[model samples]
Structures are given as C-alpha cells and as structure tokens.
Target: MDMAKDLRGRKALTARPLRLAAATATAGLLLTLAACQDGGADRADDGQASIVAPGRPGEKSRTLTPEQAAKAKPDDSPNAADQSYVQRMIEHHRQALTMSALAPERAAADPVKRLAERISAAQKPEIGAMQKWLALHPAPTAGSGTTAPGHGHDHDHGSMPGMATEQQLKELADARGADFDRLFLKLMTAHHEGALTMAGEALAGGNNPAVEEMANEVVATQSAEIHRMRAMG
Candidate 1:
C-alpha cells in the first residue's frame, strides 16, 4: 500500500506539470494563428500591410492578396476580445502620459521626473502605433476602436479599467507640487497594474504577431514600471 501511494503521488505530480505545459503550448499556437473576421466589415485587407505567417515545414504556402491582406490590418473595432485589451491599454498609457507631462511642473526629485519622461517617450509612440493600426483596420462602424484581444469583452468603453473618468483627470490636472507627484505615482501604479492584467490576458488568448508582441512588451515594461513607481512612491 505504501508503494502504491508513492506511485500515485508521483503520477499526480507529473500530471500537474504536463497540464501546465499543455496550456503554455496551446497559448503559443493560438498567437501564431492570429486571424479575425468581423461579423460585419466582411472586407479583406484595406490595401497595405500583409502578415507572412511563418511557414511550417510541410504545409503549402498561403499568401493573402492586397485586398485580403488589408482586411487583416488593425481596425478601431477590434473584436470584443482584442478591443478590450487595446482599449484598456490605451487608457492606461494615456494616464501615464498625463503623469509624465506633469513631471516638469511638479516632481521634486529628478529621478521621478526622469521616470516620467521615459514613460512619456515610450508610450506616446506606442499610442500612435496602436491608434494607427486601429485606423487602418476596417470595422463595422467608424470610431469603434475597442478590441479586447482574447476574452469576448462587453464593458462600456467609458468604464474600462485604468481609465480615469473626466472628473478624475480634471482633478489630477488641478494638483500641484508634491500633491501632483503623490497622486501621479499612485494613479500610474494602478494604471500600470491594469495594463499588466490586459497584457496577461492577451498573452493567453491572442494570435496576431503584432498583438502578441505588443502584449509581451507591455507585460515586461509595465511590470518594471510598477517596481519603479513603488520605489519612487
């Protein structure tokens, strides 16, 4: 009976690791297979970008025509899942930009100001990238930039996580000196954490290389920022 118990324990331990491995492998595969068809746009590529899906050893090559390729380009209304990821990240980074803009005026420590500067530098371009992707992308409607990445999200655009309401932003803008620094740190930290959550979700469910790469970068960079904000807080 003791020997039987040991065998069962070993099997359980082995099975646990296998399950985790399976999950990780499945996630990697999904990212590699990124493809989306809006229930509506029904359009293929708009005109420019093309995704050359990596070749498997034996499969015949598949290439999308310019029109079909254009269809794959990022759109404002990313699927409910992809939109959730994109929208929340955009809002999170917007707050960081606000915090960074305030640094010149209120941050007492050069380090805090420097961190804010870095945050602004990094996120501004990324914001443009994401926004441009959304613009080029075809959607069922205009101005519907709200892809969630993985989960079929249904949150109101106005109430996404990491987004500060108009009133909250106005309050932040009104702050001065150490008050600005304190609120900025606190808010940015929360914002960074929210981005991490969205990125993690994308890593688990997203397929597009562009989307996956962006999500991975968000996870690593924002994670570092969380530590930076904590130290500076």
Candidate 2:
C-alpha cells in the first residue's frame, strides 16, 4: 500500500509541474499575440495604407534617372529607373548594415539593440542579392560587364530618411544611457522612413520582380516597426 501511494505521489508531482507549465505557456502565447495585434497598421488621413512611415523635418527624395535616360519601354528590357533603384538600393542597404552594426553599443535598451541588430541582419543578405543582380546586369561601362543604364550616380548621397547624417552618427557614437536610446530611435526611425521613400518610388515606377519584392518588404516591415517604435516611446 505504501509503495503504491509513493508511486501515485510521484505522478502527482510530475503532473503538477506539467500543468503549470502548460498554463504559463498559454498565457505567454496570448500576451505575445495580443502585442502583435495591438501594434496595428498605419493608415493615411484618407484611409489608405501608409506605405511610408512618418518622417523628420529633413526628408527629401533622392533624384532618379530622367525619362530620356530610360530604356525604350519595358518590353524585355530593364529601364533606367529600375537600374538606378537597384544600384542605389544596394548602396543604401549597405549603409543600413553599417548603422545596424553600431546599434548595440549605441542602443540604450535591450529592445532597441535587438531591433537594430535585426535590421542589420535582414539587410546584409539583401545587399548581397542586389549586388548579384548588378553583377548579372553589369553597368554599361567600357562594355566589359553586363550593361545597365545611368551607370553612374554623381553624388552617392545615401540620402534615405532614416540614414544617420555624419553629424547624427557622431551624436549616436557619443551618447549613452537614455541619450543613446533617444538618438537611436530618432536616427533609425528616420533611416527607415528614407528606405520607405525609396521603396515607394520603386513600387510606383520599377518593373523588376526582385525590386518590387524588396520594396514591398520594406513597406510592410518598416510600417510595423514604426508603430512599435512609437509605442516604445
């Protein structure tokens, strides 16, 4: 009788922890899902989905190729805007990785650091993909590599919205504690906004599938993140 009672007691002990664990897991799942849902999507004043996030005061659209520089229609040919978007986005994405790499040291909190790291991780591969596309469709230089239009950009400004200006980056480098947090949020927010601008233009004008895919991704992810950052603030 004692042995049977001991066995039953052990089963009860094991079952109790399992039951508690299940309940805890369920609660956690509910909370996480709730957070995701509450984050919500951005809508314009007119109720359109805001593909571009909110911007700071200094935002500007980087110049694109003019119409005369473009290919003769889209029938089996890449256009000038398409080529410029790919090349510039590749450069733009590289800068994102650069900024993301600095986030942990500059971030004020675990969440900010993680978000920056995530952005960096996601953009690195995209940089490589864009480079690959360019390699396959070489800029029409001395005619060696595959040729594309508007092969040269005069400024290479890295002009996207969320991008850290040299001065802002310096501020980020010098910041610590809450200062770091605020600067990071402000800088990254602007950086993301700039990417959204580029993406929006691409969606409206570019014809490449890869270009469209990256543009859509930028819109969706940045839109969600803008809300998350706003909530965090």
Candidate 3:
C-alpha cells in the first residue's frame, strides 16, 4: 500500500509540470497572436489610401497614407515661374491701361469706347492686387542686383509677348475716330492673346496658390475680351 501511494504521488507531480508547461506555451502563443492583431490594427488605423509625400533635403520621397500626410505642413511656396509671371503680367496690364487711356477721347465707336472703359476698370484693380501680392512676397535678393531679373519695377518689354512697339503706340495716340478704333481693337486683341499665353505658362509652371488663382482669372477675363474684340471686327 505504501509503495502504491508513493507511485501515485510521483505521477501527480510529473502531471503538474506537464500541465504547467502546456499552460505556459498556450499563454505565449496567445500573447504572440494578440501582438500580431494589434500590429494589423495599427496599420489599418494609419489609413489604407497611399499618397506621394515629397522628400526632405537629401531624403528620397516616400509613400504615405492621407492621414499620415495630413500631419505634415502644407507647402504653397512661390516658384520662379510664379514670380516671373506676376512681374511680367503687371507690366503687361500697364500697357493695356495706357492703350485704354486713349479710348475715351480718341475712339469714335460707342462700343469701342465702352470696351476700353471696361478694360481699364477691370485692369486697374487687377494691377493693385498684383502689386499687393508682390509686396507681400518679395523676391530673394541674394546674388541678385538692385533690379532682379523679373522684378515688378523693371521688365523686358521685348521679351513680353503682346506689348505694342513705340511706333504702334505713337500711331494709336496720333489717330482719332475710326482709325483709332480699328488700330486699338487689333492691338488689344494681340495684347490679350499674349496675356493668355503668359497666364497659361504661369498655370503650367507656377507653384503658389495665389499666383495660380491670378493666372486663372487672367485667362478667363482675357479670353472673353479676345472674343469680344474679334466679334467687334
């Protein structure tokens, strides 16, 4: 009887360790499964949709979820194209203003006079807005001279697409009545088309949101003006 009881006790001790080992393995497996589930949840939470994130200096760009990208600051910094377009466009508008200035006294047709008045009215405010924008966002002066290449104060009239020559302006200024109307419409049409070209370039190349908005407005307004001028002829 004593031998049987000792045998039974040893068997029970052995069974306990086996049960303990099984329990430990089961607990470890449960922990591992829980960690895997948590990792998947984290990935799901980060957002499923991926977006291209611009890289930092010396870093390669990486794909990110919209949620992750939203954490980053927005970049609407003006590019060189934006600056050039704004500066050149200001000069461009000034020429239009000069042309329109002659219309009230020189233009014979009522329609021509009214068109010139509208152009002047629209452009004057646009000039103010562009001037304000330039003031707000000044060009970098590093390594640049007193007058930057695309500075608002200074521009290359020859480089601009639609600018009238000295002789053309002289002709317009000297002419009166029907002659003035004809010349003005023709010159203004070419001028507006040139503006459209500039605006299109700005839209394609510029980075600044404000510049983009300005360029789009120019395109819309000038396109309408072009149609009107063509219709007048």
Candidate 4:
C-alpha cells in the first residue's frame, strides 16, 4: 500500500506539470491573437487613404497618402504660381478699374456706365484682397517689384493678352459719347476674357487653397460679365 501510494503521488506530480504547460501555451496564443486584433483596430482608426499617380516614361509611380494630401492650414505658405497669379491679377484689375473710371465721364449709354460701375465695384475689393494676400505672403525679390499699388503702369501692355495699348488708351481717353461707349465695351470684354484665361491657369497650377478659391471666383464672376457684355453688343 505504501508503494502504491508513492506511485500515485509521482503520477500526480507529472500530470500537474503537463497541465501547467498546456495552460501557459494557451495563454500565449490568446495574447498573440489579441495583439493582432489591436494592430488592425489602430490601422482602421488612422483613417488614411492612398492615391497612386502614374509615372512618366521609365519612372516609378508615386503614391500620396492621406496624411500628405490633407487640407492645409490657412497660414500655409504660397507657391510661385499663387504669387504670380495674385500679382498679375491685381495689376489686371487695376487697369480695369482705370478703364471703368473713365465710363462716368466718357460713356454715353446708361447700361455701359452701370456695367463699368459693377466692374469697378467688384474689382476694387478683389485688388484689395490680393494686396492683402501679397502682404501676408511677400513674394521673392524678383516677383516683389511688380506688386506696388497702382504700379501696373510699369508693366508691358503687350505681354498681357487683351490689354489696351498706350495708343488705344490714349484713343479711349480722347474719344467721347458713342465712340467711347463702343470702345469701352470692346476693351472690357477682351480684358475679362484675358482674366478668365489667367484664372484658369492659376487654378490648374496653384497649390494654395485660398488662391484656388479666389481663382475660381474670378472665373465665375468674369464669365457672367463676359456673357452680359456680349448681350449688350
């Protein structure tokens, strides 16, 4: 009976170790599974998406993750395209204002004068906005020289599409009554069209959200004006 009891005790000891090892293995497996589940949940929480852009010939494609493409803060710096667009547009609008100023005294038609008034009202505020944007941004030295208020006269009129030549401006300044009305309509129509072209370019190339919004506004407002001008003629 003593031998039998000793044998039973040894067997019990061996079985206890095996049971403990089994429990340890089971716990380890559960922990591993839990870690994997947590990792998946974290990735889901990140809310990141990806975009793949096609590469040029012989080049690898690029991917933009959500973190990279996320909307920028308002104070984010402007790009070259944004600066150029703002500067050029400010000058463009200034010239339009100059032409519009003439309408009160020179234009014969009420509709023409009203159109001029609308153009002036719209562009003056836009010029101010662009000026403020430029003040905040402060372009590089090369681009900076062009940004002075009322300094648009220094620009080469030939470079800007639809800009009135010095001679044409002189003629507009000299003309009166019906001639002035006709000339103003033609010149303003072309000017607005040029503005549309510039705004479209800015929208395509500019990275700044504020500049893009302004460019879009320019496109919409000037498009409507263009239609009105066409109808008036």
lDDT of 3 at 169: 98
197-230: candidate 1 lDDT, tens digit per residue: 6666655544444665687677667777778888
What is the per-residue lDDT of model 2 for residues 135-210, given as tens digits with 9 covering 90 to 100?
Answer: 8765555454443434445435545445667887777777887887887777777776777777766655655656
- TM-scores, all models, native as reference: 0.58, 0.60, 0.67, 0.63
Worst 10 residues of 1 by lDDT: 35-44
Query: Whose lDDT is greatest here?
Result: 3
> At residue 216, what lDDT does model 2 achieve?
66
Q: What lDDT would each prediction earn against the true structure?
A: 0.61, 0.61, 0.75, 0.70
For candidate 1, what's the RMSD? Answer: 13.3
Clashes of 1: 23
Give the alpha carbon lDDT tens digit for every residue of 140-223 in model 4: 664565444432334454676667777888888898999998898899988888887777666655667688778877877887
**Model 3 spans with C-alpha error above 4 angstroms:** 1-71, 142-154
Which candidate number has the best TM-score? 3
Tell me the alpha-carbon RMSD of every candidate: 13.3, 24.6, 26.9, 26.8
Worst 10 residues of 2 by lDDT: 63-72
Select the stronger candidate by TM-score from 1 and 2. Answer: 2
Candidate 3, residue 33: lDDT? 40
